[model samples]
Target: MEIIILIAVGMLASLCGAIAGLGGGFIMVPILALMYVIPVSDISGTSMAVLFVSAISSTIAYAGQKRIDYRSGLTFAVAMIPGSILGAWTTGVIENRVFFVSLGIFLVLMAISINFKPKKSRDGFLKPNVSRSLLDASGQRHEYSFNMTFAAVVAFFVGFLSSLFGIGGGSVMVPTMILFLAFPPHIATATSMFSILLSAFVGTVSHAVLGHVMWDKFIWLAIGALAGGQIGARVASKIPAIAVVRVLSVCLLIAAVRLMFKG
Candidate 1:
């Protein structure tokens, strides 16, 4: 029965994470700590294990749909590695209360930012020095530009938070890419998932080394993530860009409120 519950959680996490590019960590970690009585120390690593699997599965699905912007994804992912390493290293040093409270606050801010008067490149407010063009699976063309410096800076922080919280940083990545980088919503979501693979892999290995991983439950979560990720990726391809943002914002708000109380 416990095993069944874990898989169900994994499925829910992967489904929502894939849709929002949040990597389900925002959902999984709080539940594991507050409901399942899992230690906060182990939650991050276990969340990472689930995220790694979902990321890979979703990336494949998105790649086949030609939604992934590999060039941008790779650039951001490379910049995120150092931060990922550092975040994983500090997991042991930070107190559990501090971790949860900080995470709760961060999520609250994120929820407000993304939901209230959302920002996008479509407004024709600003233009950057870089330009990019890509074609998706449906042969739809997307072209945009953004400030490389801003993107790199955002990527660094995203990595840090991702590793620290065992999330894919999609909560940050998706919004930043769309608002600052001028990326199309679908493209951002797919690229975020692709980029998460690298950071999650690093964080997972680091946590495992630090003996924070819950190995007994890893396989079940991973299995559920793989299955749910495929469904999520498929659904994402059909959804409107604005819908994606709204769903993510709601999830963030809910997660933030729940986590604040849990902490």
Candidate 2:
């Protein structure tokens, strides 16, 4: 029964993940923490294990829709590796109580970021200079600009956060692409999931090496995520872009408060 319940939760979490490019960790970690089903120190690792599987599942689904920006996503994903390894090392040394509170604070900040009105970004070392255009399977044309110079730097931190909090960094990646990279919301989410696949893979391996993953529970979560990933891709196509971001913002706030009161 516990396994069954966890699978259900995993499905719901992955649904939110695929739609918002969250990698399901943002939803899985807090709920597991709140439920006290596992040790706090192990939660992030377990979440990463789940995220790794879900990222693969969602990326495949997104590919079918042709929503992914593979060239850019691959570059950013490669940039994430060093930071991911470093963050996994750091997680092994942090206090569990401090970890939960920190995760809560991070979630609150993500809520603010997604809900905040987007402003035009100024030119800097990170300035986007390269233009890109793509036509999706649905006949929509997307035009955007982003530079690898800034994207690589951001991807490094994104990888660090994915390992540190087990939220898979989608909360940050999606917004960064949409606001700074000028990517359309649908494309941003799709591409973010692609980058998350690589980051989660690195983070999960690092955590597993440190014995942070709980394979017994993580197995069921992965199964549910596999199914949810397929459904979420289809659902995302029908929803308005604004609705997806709004929903993510609200969910992040709720989860943030829940985690804040924990530990």
Per-residue lDDT of model 1, residues 1-263, tens digit only: 87898898899899999988878887788778765666565888889878999999999999999988888889889888887888788775767566667777887776666654445344312447667788998999988877777787788888888887786688788877876677887898899999899878888888899888898888888888998899999998889878987887887776777667666
Every model's TM-score: 0.92, 0.89
**Candidate 1: where is the Cα deviation over 4 Å?**
115-127
Candidate 2 per-residue lDDT, tens place, 153-202, comes to 89999899888778778877776776566777788889999999988899
RMSD values, in order shown: 2.2, 2.5
How good is model 2 by TM-score?
0.89
Error of model 2, residue 29, in angstroms = 0.8
lDDT of each: 0.81, 0.80
**Predicted model with the maximum TM-score:** 1
